[model samples]
Target: MVFFKYPEQIRRVMYTTNTIEAIHRQFHKLTKTKVRFSKQNNLLKLLYVGIKNASTKWTMPFPNWNLAVSQLAICFEELLDATLDL
Candidate 1:
């Protein structure tokens, strides 16, 4: 499979979709507790606060991030260069 062609470190990063799901779960929990919002802005504010709080918990670096970056750099050198030029 194409996924297995990459190093293990890169594969781990690719499969770790739980982080996004966790954020959604947290947002759901925050919004679920409050059934009513007086305004749309209030709901937005609650989600903003939830995001801020969730960001704090993400302070740790991803495991083997350096290795993953190196692998990605090698795999997508041309794409990376194009992005960097923009």
Candidate 2:
């Protein structure tokens, strides 16, 4: 797999679980203060608010994103070209 071959720097970019973990941490932080939710809707609302707040902090582009995309395109040139044709 290309995943096994990529360098550590590139691997981190490809593996986005870290970003997801951060978002989960933010959600946990928001909810940990409260012991219980009055209703499911209230919990949903809180999560929605958390997502909005988290998304705001994502304005900056990922480091080396262009280089990463270029490398990915090179790795999957034929597949990408085929998809573009469709």
Candidate 3:
């Protein structure tokens, strides 16, 4: 857990791969029934719809986001500010 070096608030934000894994699982579920798509757009559209449906449940905000951002700003002061125009 390389993220362990960060504070608890930041660790919670960084530690989980669940969201990405869930998205992959959704894509798998969407695509597994078909061996081939006749057109590239069809596959892309399916994945896009799957992502849209999965993202509908993402209404909740992360906890302690401001604190985590402050911590990140301290740790990556020059990089974060320069990247985000903060």
Tens digits of per-residue lDDT, candidate 3, 17-64, equal 369888989999999999999999999999999999999977788877
Query: Which candidate number has the best lDDT?
Result: 3
**lDDT winner, 1 or 2:** 1
lDDT of 3 at 49: 98
Cα lDDT tens digits for candidate 1, 53-84: 99898887787777777787788888876775
Comparing candidate 1 with candidate 3, which one achieves the higher TM-score?
Answer: 1
> Which 10 successive residues of model 1 have the least lDDT summed?
77-86
Error of 2 at 8 (Å): 4.8
Q: List the residue pairs that clash in candidate 2.
A: none
Give each model's whole-structure lDDT: 0.84, 0.80, 0.86
Query: Which segments of model 3 are wrong by more than 4 Å?
Result: 17-19, 83-86
Measured with C-alpha atoms, the lDDT of residue 30 in candidate 1 is 95
Residue ranges of candidate 2 with Cα displaced over 4 Å:
1-3, 15-17, 78-86
Q: If ranked by TM-score, best first, what sequence of candidates would result? A: 1, 3, 2
